[model samples]
Target chain A: MIGRLNHVAIAVPDLGAAAERYRSAFGATVTGPDALPEHGVTVMFIELPNTKIELLAPLGADSPIAAFLARNPAGGMHHVCYEVDDILAARDRLLATGARVLGTGEPKTGAHGRPVLFLHPKDFDGTLIELEEVA
Target chain B: MIGRLNHVAIAVPDLGAAAERYRSAFGATVTGPDALPEHGVTVMFIELPNTKIELLAPLGADSPIAAFLARNPAGGMHHVCYEVDDILAARDRLLATGARVLGTGEPKTGAHGRPVLFLHPKDFDGTLIELEEVA
Candidate 1:
């Protein structure tokens, strides 16, 4: 089951500008510009008291965010991540109830170095949901 | 500035079916089918350990969610709300930084009966940001 709201990811055309806005306007601590080739994103985290905001930019033309940006040139909310106690258990439970997990239907190492899986947007209405196992 | 994440709102085509999915699949405590005619939406809250998920559906043909659903029939994430210590102060600061606040730049009573202001999605890289003054 879903635990804490880990972080809400936003796809941005300019990661640095987005990070700067959080830094200067909101005074949030901006961390990372970590290039995650596996996820095909360059990400930055805006630290908050209770949760974090992830700013993502496409790493390549083939990146998923790239397609999102192509449609929404201004970029937008990409996904919402929820922490789980056990990734496999959560996946199984969701699958048993007919929820479709994205990707290879297995957990993969996420940006946080924890196991994560994405749920199909179609299954959850229209919002893409991500489940990350707490490390 | 933003405080805690108040909730992530998802616009669903079928409010009851969406609430049922959360209750039966994730065992989330679902509350409300509260109709806010001002916002032209009916909403439900899916309680979580650290945050809540708001499920929204169009209350009328004029509802904004109806437009979103017309484009995305499956439903999807609508907006993210963040709590602010002082709504007025937050609004001034954001405006000073060239961020355009939506709807005549005035705070309206949101679902929680708290003063809330919305920031333009274009200004924030396409993610509609809501700042709610915690009561």
Candidate 2:
């Protein structure tokens, strides 16, 4: 079951500028400067009360983040994440309900070394949703 | 500093159906059957730990939810909120940055008697953002 919101991902054309803007806007402190090679982008997170605002910028033209930016030039909000206790159980239920799971099985490490899984946007009414388990 | 994400609002075509689907998928419990007349919509919140999934359906065509649904028929995610310590201070700083505030002063009351205010979508790159003080 979904536990709590984990983070909201935003695709930015430039991660540095976006991070600076948020820090200036909310006095948010930076958590990390990390990259997920599989996703082909770099990310920075600003930790908040129950979640964080993650900024993603593509490392190359072939990156998914690049494609997302090409479709949304204004850099709109990208996805919402929910924390779950059991990733596999949640995946099973979502799959049973016809929700498209991005992967075939259990989750691997995601941003910040946390286990994560993504539900396809098509299955979630056009909003890409991610499920993460921190503990 | 901002700590964690509070909630993300999604404007739906039908609240009852959306709520039902969510319940069936995750076994989530319904937390509210309330209305925010000021926002012109009847909302149902499905509480999940640190946040809740708020389903908003317009009470009338003039309601913002109606307009949002009219623009996006497939349904889409609406907003992201951050829980803050001082609403007034946050408002003051946001104003200083030239962000457009929907309400001129401190938050009055929102969906569930929680103090709330909205930042115009234009200022936040086309995503309507709401700030709520849940504590």
Candidate 3:
């Protein structure tokens, strides 16, 4: 089952502007342009007291978020992540309900190096949901 | 300054279906169909351990989210709310950065009964942001 609301990701056209704006606008701590080449995106974390806001920018032409940026050039909320205790059990439970798990239907190592899976947006009322298993 | 991620609001066409999916998919607690008709919204809170996921449905013709739902008929992430220790001070800081605050630039009572302000989506990378004052 989903536990905590992990982090909410926003896909931006420019990571630097996004980070700087959060810094100037909110006087908040912003960290990283950490590039995850495997995922084809660079991310910066806007650290908050309770949760994090992830600013994502396309790292390559084939980046998964490139299309999202194309549609929303100014950027927008990309996905919402929730923590689950058991990845396998959670996957199975969601599968039983006929909800689709994206990718190869296997958990992949996410930005945090935690096992994570994406659920079909259509099945979840148009929201792309990422489920991360946290110990 | 921004502190906790107060809640993430998702605008859904069907409040019932959205709440049900979250409940059945995550075994999460879903509460309320609380109608804030004054705000032209009917909402349900998907309670998570760390924060909450707010499902918003248009309650009347002039519902603020009606246009959002029209654009995203299947439902989508609406806006992200962050808690501010002193909203007035926070507003001034953001304003100094030339960031445009939505509406009359005055705080309004939000869904949770906290004084809140909305920042222009264009100013925040096309992502609508709500700043709620919290103790």
Candidate 4:
């Protein structure tokens, strides 16, 4: 159902500092500070040879990352994304197995401009799993 | 520097059920209920095409997973492991940047029989990071 590991998303109180850490410490290529109003996050991508790291900061008061930061003031690992060949098919298959998909059960444009959906953390042994459709 | 995502570790109260979920739901190849007494955890790996998912359960009363399960009852994402070319060099680089490596700042033999070290969650924006020296 899941393909390659797309990226790991981290919620950070200070996105710039987190990006700098990856840049200076690992010499990673950092890109974007793009505001994703629909997702309520301002994101940056730290690219690596195999996978990418996403740094997310709250974009508004109701941002999910803001709530996460409130619980863990320093920010933390928010989610892990995996690529799927067909997200809708994956969703349907998962749903058939009693998995809960987050949001309106519809795929939305993700940071990579690909369709993505989040699965309920409780259903995935407490890990928030994101499924992104591979283009 | 990180090479690839080695695995995403999830702390589960019941490793068998979690492993079964992946096996039955996604038809993933699942292996191990191996007990790592040194780490105080019993672990299983759900092998995906690209990356693996590690399901962790407490091996003893002193197990870290026991503590995590105490707080989260339902289990959750514990840590993310990334591969590195050189363990010592990565350690020195991370330390020079004031990153706190967990435990004794030395690599321990991990599940994959590789030298691995954990970074402090607090220092890493609340994300527990594991760096494994790939063979």
Best by TM-score: 3
lDDT of 1 by residue, B5-75 (tens): 88999999998999888777676789999999888999999888888889999987699778888888899
lDDT of each: 0.87, 0.75, 0.92, 0.85
Candidate 3 CAPRI category: high
True contacts kept of 2: 0.61
Candidate 1 per-residue lDDT over residues A6-97, each given as its tens digit: 99999999999998887766667899999988879999998777888899999965787888899989999889998989999888889888
Tell me the deviation in Å of residue B57 in model 1: 0.8
Using DockQ as the measure, the top candidate is 3
Off by over 4 Å in 2: A103-108, A133-135, B1-4, B103-108, B133-135
What is the Å distance of residue B55 in model 3 from its true position? 0.3
Model 2 Cα displacement at A32 (Å)? 2.8
Candidate whose lDDT is highest: 3
Q: Give the per-prediction TM-score of chain B.
A: 0.94, 0.82, 0.98, 0.94
Model 2 clashing residue pairs (backbone): A48-B2, A48-B3, A48-B4, A49-B3, A49-B4, A50-B4, A51-B4, A51-B5
Give the residue spans of candidate 1 off by over 4 A: none
List runs of model 4 lying over 4 Å from the truth.
none
Model 3 chain A: weakest 10-residue lDDT segment is A13-22
Please state the i-RMS of candidate 1: 1.3
Mind sharing the TM-score for model 1? 0.95
lDDT of 1 at A83: 90
Per-residue accuracy of model 4 over B9-124 as CA lDDT, tens digit each: 88987888898877665667899989899889999998777788889998866886777789989988889888899999999999998889988999999887889999988777
Query: Where does candidate 3 clash, by residue pair?
Result: none
